[model samples]
Target: MVLGALGVCALVLGWRALDLQVLQHDFLARQGDLRNLRTEPLAAHRGVITDRANRPLAVSTPVTTLWANPREVLAAREQWVKLSNNPVLNSRTLSQRVEANAGREFIYLARHLAPEQAQQVLDLRVPGIYALTEYRRYYPAGEVTSHLVGFTNIDDVGQEGIELSMDNRLRGTPGRKKVVRDLHGRVIQDIAVLEEAHPGSNVTLSIDLRLQYLAYRELLAAVTRNRAAGGSAVVLDARTGEVLAMVNQPAYNPNNRSGVQTAALRNRAITDVFEPGSTIKPLTVAAALESGLVSVNSTVDTRPGTIRVANKTIRDHRNYGVIDITTVLTKSSNVGTTKLALAMEDHALPAFMEHFGLGTATGIPFPGESDGMLPIRSRWRDIETAALSYGYGVSVTALQLARAYAVIANGGIKVPLSLEKVDQPPQGERIISAEHASALVSMLETVISAEGTARRAKVPGYRVAGKTGTVHKLTAAGYADDRYVALFAGIAPAEDPRIVTVVVVDDPQGQDYYGGLVAAPVFGSIMAGVLRTLNIEPEQPVGTYAGVIDREGRL
Candidate 1:
């Protein structure tokens, strides 16, 4: 009786254990499905970028991807051979195919497949082969807008320029849906809704396509004429801080990105910095006049063209005698600007620099703004101060120089530079008195006259105030070669300034490498085209543009 009772208990325990193990299998499988299932990141379409006129600069286009699950491919080896012959794949040998197909149960055959190629693969119905939907960023303007629109990586991430800066807003969220598959590996009814992605917002830039083309053409011509290593140009609306056009040459093809790292691909206008040379003279003169150190008629003792200060001999490009402060700028006299800068407290200069947006990013909203160097006043020597007066011992990006001119063009108010559309204009701080600014404008107008250096910069229908600069390129050790950076920074229609431009030709090699010849003509050509494109009525009256600069080079 005791043995029978023990056997019965053992049987009951055995039966209970089997029931618990088998009956709980369903719960374990559900937990596994929760842990193992996942959704991969899919890049949502990037928004289109258009010029102010709503012409496409960049747009996202539909593309397809080629993928394969080797395990699912039950096709004969010969059929696999035919599919591998695709030019995109370029598999010549069976060994290559085996090596490529080795190890991975699933592999991506190609990304960004052309529609035709993808369709061909689909028609073949090559079992394991599949096509995935994707999108690609395309610059419809082609090389015309590459520098501004920029290109994305294969992963559709913006890498530079406006693309990088506005990437977060331009790259939309992605969506996913979970579904159960049949034994044949086909998607069935939706098991779960993973997420829905929001599309990226469109970006509208301040650039006008017509002006952009003009600027690009002029810059290209300047580079070719000067035999320069590279060049950059920018045009800004003086009344409004709108950037109409910008170009940095030795550019790249965004559509084909294999050689994107070329040195010229860099945006010299906003990214690179250099000693501004005499292009900065107008600012110093403006500062002097604003501080009441001198008037436009103030006579600076610039006799002898050279002066010794703090163990350094400060010399001009050439000497001038007893020139007024205005002539000092007209002739770009280094000694005169030095004397004027010396009269002001050394520390007060930084205030002007700050107002003009030098030594700081202009915040133009492009990527890689170089905050050019400006040392403390206390660290300056007499020679350094003199150098600073003539735009040396200081480095400033091209955009910064344009900003300074913008302040003068705007009648002493220095507004922040902008790239996007603004419903309401931004306010600016007063940097100089309006009278002083007008005085400076009068001086700059002389720069484009026959008696001045930049004779090529004259606009027949308008008065232009501008400055010319030529500086030696710096090497690791010091300034090297006769390779110079020739530049002109100008404002048009000084009576009612409307646009500010800065043009620089890097390492110009021809006889016409001086700013007067190399860069000034470019400014003229660009302004002429842009003015007509924007329908900016010539201040000089109809047919006056042709006479802006007479055949004899007299203003």
Candidate 2:
């Protein structure tokens, strides 16, 4: 009888627990009904950019943004009033801030807010205020890859660089949550969902940091030494068209994007145009040789240091009368080169210029790439033809000029330049004969030797072949005084050419305009640094080879 009484007590207790929980469950849930109705954004992370070895170049870090539900604040007006009394609040007049945001369902307090500031706001215990998460892009290389990595706005939207070009791919759709809520202001469960957030894919670049730094330091030193307004450098692998380095002076840090002048942000390599000057002579010579108008040994009469065509007189930079075609390049004899270009058919000259990749965009992956102006044949006056022969009256961007030399370095085949790696470059169409390219290389090599104008560009262990150009800057009115573009385009280890590096120094203020003194030294210095960084063994021992070296097998 006693055991039965204990069992009866246990059953009674169980019944009472069930009565409170199961029988009254609906009533309790009703009290917390709308709690589950809160809507939250599901954001996807942006992709990281890395080098081939997965070394970070661009990265993203999570940052917080503060916002508010105006309706909730309105309901808790007493708490909001207490919040309004804070002195550090942004609004000068709390009444105006409350009024502007009074009727709205949502209002953004601030974005990418500092955590300490956010904590202060949270400590106020304002009813509707909340924080959301977002990603901010950071370029680790700083100004080093600023031109390539670009930047984005606070909204996680791309405004420039790879971010702008790949905005569609880099930016992901944000997901949202919806739910049903009871009158008691508590959500029950999720009701519907769509547009799932997906993270962006990784983007890899062809740029090598080692080679990039090499070019950067060398070019920076050149501009400082020459007292130049600006400088640009490019290194392209001749075999694959892989762009190893794209360096520029006056580079801006992507980290600080405020109040930046447009000029400082410009990519001089692809955007700025200048007269190509004497660097253009090789193309003219190639056309002449290809068309059988001249041979490497053929001579031209460069008499009196000048030649008259129509009303204009073309003058050699300095006279070397009756020089061979090779000697024309060695001495930079403009009169001989012009005479050679004039010998070709007018139509063929333009065709050859087009073949050399002038007056076209190089199709580099960058924003605002200018397709430099190449005047039509109809615009050519007689003087224009002769002047064009020596690189004047025609504006070409640094990219177009570099690609033109790349064609020569690539064994007369024109391969499209790429910022990204290629499994294989499509078989490029032959633009010039191999024989003509070989002849041009021979002439160009002399330019880096003691007999040539660009002797300063010679590398001790390497046989370097290239052209030096010094052109006058054009003013709105016409050509101006004392301003010049000094440029050098060359391939190193000429016996087995690899990277074709081009260096352009704009408007040096110093006493030198000759590319030898201004741009060629920059080229030599950059190439040497690149070789050392890449662990490319020198062709000679320390202080062994001074100039030309016969083609030798590498270790």
Candidate 3:
């Protein structure tokens, strides 16, 4: 009976071996392969961001991330301890992580290390340690282009600015490949790639690095010299409506944002809004001209330099008695603008401003772009209308103000603004009659004359047409008497407009808080550089000002 039982046991064991090896062969083989074979991600390089001239603004650099199988690392004991010697890896933290993830097969040991640095760790020959290739974003222009080009996160995802707006286009798809690993979880054999990685497509922005540098330098100097809170400047190709340069003061370096203030990260030119002050006068005059209620030759009486609207009293710098419409804008007269606004039909002014791109988005591909507030009321109050005329009761960003001037520069056409390079000039909607636009440009030229408010805004060889604005910053207690926003918006080579620029210096301290004193000089300096950089020919002799009134009021 013992012999029979032993023989039966051997038969049963043979049958079980056959069943295991033959019946479940594929399933068992798959389970075994799962332990040794793995699918690894192949990092894709992000696209290059460049200026219109193809200068690199942002690029990606190769990096290495070191990872290890926690179980293997803990098992290696002494071998793992050697890794703690590297400065980037904390000994206690590493030990804690490995111990906590003791059952896991993978954990990051060090991320985004330079290849040379990662090689030093690999040379130690730890059993479970391995390196994976990755890419990190690098800004070539640093803080100069930080506000616009933006920065990305450690995972190569865009976090702000253009990087965030165009993320999907800039971040390419990651590929995958199969690899065989040893028991310690180290890659041992190369396997076939399941997919190939495609690098992201390049982005070409309308920004001119040369002009960007010019704008950045000048804006920084003005902000520092004036001891201002912050500022923004925008330069646009008037004919094409493409942004040549856009910069903000209090900029933060995107490459290294260790302790950057949250406020410094904002692209203020497009994101922040303020009452445009006297900068809106030119638009107000345009509205009046379009309404046929006023003419360039028409005059408004300024008697005692102040006027009453409801419970508010509007005042100019001083009493000039009476002034023409052109003089109204040249002087940035609140009384004159109020007269113009009060004479027009309530809806007329707002409708005209809307046509000029106020209260609307410029359609530029940027994150956090604010469409400035243009109030709509079923019934208009005299005070509201007057305030709207002189650039209150409404708000605008520096970019929107630049675009409004571009309409007059582009001969009444309102072209869509573009952040990217434009191969062709875009079609534009006609906001005003070209005749009226030309007439307005001619009137604005007087503002840069010797006797006008923005005399300092003049470029030596070109006829500049612009307006000056100094607005009391509105606070919770109402308009702050001590704080001001100095602004200058202009078109260069006014006869044949090429570029439109707007400079906004907020809360300028000291006695020089007026737009003509603070912002106009910045406008002149930047416009001069831009005009020369574009190789635009001079329209007149450098020192000559024919047909322009002299400081003595003599033509």
Candidate 4:
């Protein structure tokens, strides 16, 4: 009976072994693989950002991030002390994190580590610790191009400027790969790639690095010299409407932003708006000229240099008995511009200003760009009409002002502004007759002459056409008596214009707050450098306008 019972047990055990090994082999293998296999991420390289000349503005560098399977790490608590020996990891903090997340599968140990440093930590061969190849963004131009190129977060995400605008094009898709790991959670075997990483496409901007540097340096100097709150400078290609250079003062370094102020991050050229002051005179005069209400030779009388409308008084610096329309712009006469606007149909001035791109966004892809305010009223007051004509009721950005001047520079055609390299000249909208535009350009040239408001804006070898603007900063209490925004907008080599630049010095302190005193020199200095850098031929003959004033006090 005992022999029979033992033989029965042996038979049952053999049958059970066969069932386990042969029938369930596939299921068991999959269960084991689940514990050892992982679908790891393959980080894709971000795109390069460059200037129109292919000079790198922003680039990415490879770095390593250390992570761990907390459960696996907690199992090997002895190794935690070993990790603490490395400067990057703290033993107490590591223990607390491991304990707090004891049930979890993963946690970050360290991030953005130098390859060499990460290698050192990995060489210790700590259990459950792993490294991932990641990227960190770097700006080569530093603060000089910070406001334009912008900066990315630690995870390589763009936050501002062109970086934010073109984030998708700059950020590539990360890939995936299946890998086998040991019991310690370290990658041990390379498996098959599930998806190939597609690196981001490179971006080429219209910004010229040379011109950007020039703009930054001169703008910084002007801001410091005038003790102004801040400033912006923009240079645009008249032919293509490409932003050759755009810069702002109080810039912050993108690479090291420890305590960067929020205000410093603004791309002021496109984002900030202010009353354009006398800078809008050219457009107002253009409106008058386009309306046929006044000829270029027509004159406005200003016996006392002050005009009153609706109990509001508009005054000029001094009295000029009677001046022609050209002289009106040359002197930046408030009385002259106010009279021109008052003579037009209420809708005519605002409609003409709209054609100049005022109170409208330039359609730049930049973030935080302001449309600026252009009030639309069903009925117009006499004072409101006067104020709008001289740029008080309306507001504009530096870029908007630049584009308006560019329209005049491009012979009354308005091209859409571009932040990227324009492959071909874009079709432009004809906003004004070329005849009137040319006449306006000729009249603007007088502003840089000796007797004009912006004589300091003159470039020695170029016939500059520009206007000076000095506006009291409007506050909640009304126009501030102490604060002023000084402005200069001009076209260089006026005979055949190539570039249009606008300079804004906000709230220049001290008695010298005039645009010609603070902003015009900045414009002249930057234009001189840009003309020489671009190899544009000098249009004015040597000594032609240098200290040579005609009998009529014109260059």
Best by TM-score: 4
Per-residue lDDT tens digits for candidate 2, residues 1-555, read 999999999999999888878998887776655554566676787888776456777777876776776677667667656555564454334335556888886677777756776666667766666777777788888888777667888887877777787777777677876766443333456767755778887777778877777888888888888899998898887777778888788788888878777777777877788888888888888889899898778999998899889877788766778889898888888898778877877767767888777888887778887887767866466677778877886788777887888788878888878877677775787899877777788889888877787877767666779988988889887887778899998887676666688899988987777787889888878887766766767677747654443212111
Cα error of candidate 2 at position 100, Å: 2.3
Cα error, candidate 4, residue 305 (Å): 1.8
Q: Rank the candidates by lDDT, best first.
A: 3, 4, 1, 2
Weakest 10 consecutive residues of candidate 3 by summed lDDT: 546-555
Query: What local lDDT score does residue 266 receive in model 4, on the 0 to 100 scale?
Result: 95
Q: Residue 282's C-alpha lDDT in candidate 4?
A: 90
Worst 10 residues of 1 by lDDT: 89-98
Clashes of each: 2, 9, 0, 0
Please list all clashing residue pairs in model 4, or write none if there are none. Answer: none
All candidates: CA RMSD in angstroms? 6.9, 6.0, 4.9, 4.1
Kindly report which residue stretches of model 3 are placed more than 4 angstroms away from their true locations once superposed: 1-36, 181-189, 543-555
Candidate 1 residue pairs in clash (backbone atoms < 3 Å): 460-548, 461-540
Question: Could you tell me the lDDT of residue 402 within candidate 4?
Answer: 98
| Superposition error at 76 for model 3 (Å) | 1.4
The lDDT for every candidate, in the order shown, is: 0.79, 0.77, 0.90, 0.89
lDDT tens string, model 4, 1-555?
A: 999999999999988888778888888889878988889999987899999999999998999998877877777888777767677776777788778888888888889989998888787777878899999888889998999988888788889988889999999899999999886567889888999888888999999999999999999998998899999999999889999999998899999999999999999998999999889989999999888998878999976999998898889889987999999988888898899899999789988888889989999888999998888889888899899888898999999999999999999999999999999999999998898889989999999887788877878778889998999999999999999999999998889987999999999886689898889989988998999999988876756656743323345
Estimate, for each residue in 1-555, the C-alpha lDDT of model 3 and write its tens digit.
999999999999999899889988899989988888889998899999999999999999999998878877777788767767676664576788789888998898888999998888777777777889999999989999999999999999999999999999999888999999886456888788999989998999999999999999999999999999999999999899999999999999998999999999999999999999899998999999888998778999987999998998899889978889888987788999999999999788888898888998888889999999999989888999999999988899999999999999999999999999999999999998898888889989999887788887878788889999999999999989899999999998888987999999999996699998899989988999999999998888866744553333344
Among all windows of 10 consecutive residues in model 2, the one with the lowest summed lDDT is 546-555
Relative to the unseen true structure, what is the C-alpha lDDT of residue 98 in candidate 2, on a scale of 0 to 100?
52
